[model samples]
Target chain A: MSEYTPFEMIAYTGSRVLKDERIVFVGTGLPIIAAMHAQLTHAPNLYMIYEAGSLAPILEMGMPLSVGDTRAARKACYLKGLCGAFELTQRGCADYAFIGGAQVDMYGNICSTIEGHNYDKPGIRFPGSGGAGAMAANCEKTIAIMALEKRRFVKKLDFVTSIGFGDGAPDYREKAGVLGSGPYRVITNQALFGFDEATKRMMLLEVKPGRTPAEIQELVDFELIIPPDVKEMAEPTDEDLRLLRDVIDAEGYFLKRVIKK
Target chain B: MINTVSSNIKNISTLEYKEKKFEYWGPTPDESRKLMVNKSHALKDKRMSLKEAVGKHIRDGINLGIGGFVNTRVPVAIIHEIIRHGARDLTLSFQSNSICPELLAGAMILDPDRVSIKRVELAWWGYEIIGIAPMVRYLATNGIIEMDDYTNYGMSVRFKAASMGIPFIPVRDHGGSDMELVNRGKMIECPFTGKNVYLLPACHPDVGIVHTTAADMYGNARIFGAYCTCPEIAMAANATIMTTEKVIPTESIRSYPNLTEIPFPVVDTVTEVQYGAHPGASYGYYWFDMDHIKMFRSICEDFRKTGNKDALKKYYDEYIFGCENHDDFLEKIGYKTLKKLKDMDGGQPIILT
Candidate 1:
């Protein structure tokens, strides 16, 4: 058994879904790592668009400090403004969008705003949404990465800031003029999931090394579909770990906090 | 209370009889008028020093509104003082799409509760999280602090409405999409666009803390490059705290007054903190400190995973707070980290700023 660092795990999870000819709208962090891993391995031509408007620029390794990290400008073939990024997304130019959801329901509606317990007073607030609204609505396909937990994966979202897969993917599409295919997959540390193509509800596709089907199911507030063909996700390889470490080079990021005697 | 009121009436009566034979029932109407007048802007139009004016109201839980988009136009000096004083629970509200590395560093080393309402994290290209985005997500997942997420246009529209002082602004865009959050009633929504359109309310914050390259003593602030939504946010806030690099006489504003977007009347207090956006050193003032950016990212990432501020504070004390100035912050984080970061293969670090 090979050891998997957090970075390697991130790259492996991302590589599973990203294939060639996929133009992925990427945010910073895990999505970028995953996209990069895909670029390194199977999907050499994976088109990665940063929110600040770089398309398929050569990204430096390790985690980016931010989406606008100078690396983006240094590595890109082209650069566009915030508004320009949306223009591309709205026109169905992007193939896949990797986004994060604060709260998600069984329907694939995301609540990135307040937790929805109190509309007037939120427990916490984020920087206002940027192109997420357009990307969530217009992109051809979407993938949401929410770290695992019942709080994150809920029965019903407090609100849907972004729509991935809804109650009836077809029904929501008719109601909303949404052009995208909805959330294609939901990636978390615990497992990998996708919506049932027919029902558009979450169906568990793969699980992490230490997770069991029942354990994964129990953590979700809503019912998750466990397909009969569910398999264990491939653990991170040593080479993958080395690349991730070299590229992301987050030395002493949490070393002091790691409780060394 | 009745005896005091009666005594006050008698004293007024005696004084009036001795001087001009005036009658008083409830003290003098002029005295009451004076009291009422003193309550509103009666400081006699005097200009005070930055230390004197800024000392009183700077405290924790205070929301600071920064100008500019990311690191381009932030108030560096005030941020420096904020770190110097160890301000806590300082929720920042900005118009630009996301957080900057400097601000992220502050949140990482200063405060981990990077309170904001941006819809997404790291929306800009090349901006690195320095570990803040993942940290923010980690903290949000762990319930360390609240995370208010909105879509990009959603936050912008909300800021626009806030600037206009409109109670709510209805957006026709983003309707009938999965990303239409405001319409779902998860946030404030208008009844008309049940589909994809949303109603964003005015975001009148507690304080509008901004920094500009130059300003007049009368408090007219002008920023060079990418104004973002700073002026509008300042106008919408309850109080506006401004920091400027250069301070000119009020008469200086008369030359190119129209350029002064923030008038003296709009600014509550102005601190002359030069070269303020440290680590993200203000454009044209100093080169961007890549080392500082890496430190900020690393700290943010550490805070995100552990949700431990004590540890963060220790790091800050060792590196950030221990430093005398921005240069020290750069030194403690070390050029090695930045050089190592430079060696990474993929994209450059994309900071939210």
Candidate 2:
């Protein structure tokens, strides 16, 4: 395929990660696009649960600009409200939590609330956890998308908005009264990450073609479990790119964008 | 008291916060119950002006639960009225929202005494797909207002608990996170199973504002798009101020009682205002006027970045304060914009007959 933008790559990677016939509790923008692309190509039965309370909606209208947009609620199998959807996740119906965050730790604890130490005031305040926290907590597994930056991949998050493996402890989530197994994948443009089962620390599983483990490590603030068997990240096919651009995000909503420094 | 099961999350995040005593943000469960008992439950004609509804119930130091998820079916017209009427030291409660809170924040920025937000108990506050809420960033980062964050489920369940007339409800989220520590929820060992469960306090707002797809004169609302915590907020509040896209006949409502998401008793006042959630979307009626939302958002953003209120004041003067009613504001928006938005809806099926 021709050269693609970073966002297209992320969406493509997100699409590739999903398994068929499972429910994915999706956040707005890229996650929705990724899930749509997956349905169009590979995982046809992968229904989506928008946080605003619609399950398995047919996206015939267009790409919903917001998770709560009327388009997200069009022709749904079930539609209620936030309580109904999240409660379903808590009840073990949702399979994957497709989310994004501002900062993350080695254990995959995400911080989307604020950036500074003080909870009252912060250096920078992003949006609070809309559904990411509950999704990460209750959905069987979590898949996070992040910009691979040293500052974002921190030693300790300023505030943990989503529960991952706390302190790399095995019984952390169990003790926390949460139902999910916890953070399964962290997707970035440069690399794909999975947590080590024994240690529960973020481990590098794959790197983009022509990118080395050392190069990816340099972008991160914390140490990574870089195994020697790191595979090359798959590039999107031309068909995938066409579906993303021509069909899904034709309005240039999410796919056509610049990453903020 | 039961022994608390620890997530062992202490000192995980680089956060410093004072421990807050557990207290209801609004009315206690008992007080809410007392108010409900004393009120008239008759199916009287509750139709009134937005000005009267807002002015009658809105005041300083009251919890205001707003409805809608982000922009869809948001109570923008009611928000405009609240901003115009002016309510100070308000506590906002919602699961996730965008414009309603932003509009209030913009009003507060223009004149603090006129409209001030003391704090917000929320899951999220930002314009999804549009941009981050500039006002939340400006106010929160600068320590202008206190914030208590929860997951969207936590906030919704809090209202659900209140609607059920319960003091607290157990949820399967918000345990191993910072919200467990920062928010007013308590983690207690479940007496039944001996497992840890987070119990969040019920949220009963003094007044709840919501915009719905259709309603009768008695205020039994039927929401077309995502219900988005509207019914819960209305029932949980001591009083509800509601606006509807169209007032369908009560006979139509009675024919299908199952369609009424919000029964009439919970709602104190109902106002028929078409395109009520304009700038936002109303299912079967219209789609979002993205340009207009962007226009208002950029205005707020400009004031945030530049520390100037000239443009902000102009917005209030022109769109809000200058117009006496929602129809007047819609007139300023004109028929062309309304028509275009309607065309975008593509006639999603909603029953009014």
Best by lDDT: 2
lDDT of 2 by residue, B110-178 (tens): 899999999999999998888989999999999899999999999999999999999999998999999
Model 1: which docking level applies?
incorrect
Instruction: Candidate 2: give the clashing pairs.
Output: none
Predicted model with the maximum TM-score: 2
Instruction: Give candidate 2's root-mean-square deviation (CA, Å).
Output: 0.9
Docking class of 2: high
TM-score of chain A of 2: 0.99
> Each prediction's DockQ?
0.13, 0.88
- Evaluate model 2: give its TM-score: 0.99
